[model samples]
Target: MFVRIVKMSFEPSNIDTFLKNFEIKKNDIRNFEGCRFLELYRDKNTTNIFFTYSYWDTEEALDAYRHSDLFKGIWAQTKPLFNDKPQAWSVDKLESLT
Candidate 1:
């Protein structure tokens, strides 16, 4: 399994637009092939910051989604709202202490 996290900071005045766009695309993204889980998070103190957390069955699956038209469309609607460059991390399960 692969885990992906993306941290995005939106221009303060554009937050609502970003949220609405995200809301529109969330289901399609979640239903994409190989996507096992998906979530969105907001920073408690940094009100303009948000994160996208997702799980993919494999890296290839993630790569496919990244190259897909769905991503292109959503990103086109998203990039203009950014206040800073976004950051992303891809990881795999190593172990769970519990």
Candidate 2:
């Protein structure tokens, strides 16, 4: 399986708007082809910081999603809210204890 992690830092005033948009779109993302799982995380000390942790079937599958209209739409609403350029990583799962 392939894993994707995205770190996002939003402008203080835009945090709520970001959260609302995320809530509306997350289900569609999770159900997108090749997506196996999706989750959202927030930094304990940084209220404006968030992360998306997801699993995809393969790198190609992830790439397809990135190029999809769903992603374009979500990103259009999301990009303007960021306080910093977003960061992302694609990785292979090394091990899972449980």
Candidate 3:
């Protein structure tokens, strides 16, 4: 499994709008092929900071989703809300306790 995390910092006034957009499209993104899991988290100390945690079957699967029309539509709406360039990383588990 591939684990992906994306950290985003949004403009203060855009936080609510960003959450609304994310909520509207979250299900469709989670249901995409090879998507195993999806979730969003907000920073307790920073209201405009958020993170997205997701799992995919493989890097190729995630790439395919990134290139899809759904991604384009969602991203177009999402990009303008950013206060900073987003950070993203992918990992494969080597060990787990649970």
C-alpha local distance difference test of each model = 0.95, 0.95, 0.95
- Model 1 TM-score, 2 decimals: 0.95
Give the alpha carbon lDDT tens digit for every residue of 1-98 in model 3: 98999999999999989989999999999999999999999999997899999999999999999999999999999999998999999988778796
Candidate 3 worst ten-residue window by lDDT:
89-98
Name the lDDT value of residue 8 in candidate 3. Answer: 98
TM of each candidate vs. truth: 0.95, 0.97, 0.95
Clashing pairs in 2: none
True-structure lDDT of candidate 3: 0.95
Strongest candidate by TM-score: 2
12-98 in candidate 2: lDDT tens per residue? 999999999999999999999999999999999998999999999989989999999999999999999999999999989999898
Question: In model 3, which residue pairs have backbone atoms overlapping below 3 Å?
Answer: none
Report per-prediction Cα RMSD to one decimal. Answer: 1.4, 0.6, 0.9
- The candidate with the higher TM-score, 2 or 3, is 2
Deviation in angstroms for 33 in model 1?
Answer: 0.3
Ten residues in a row with the worst lDDT in model 2? 89-98
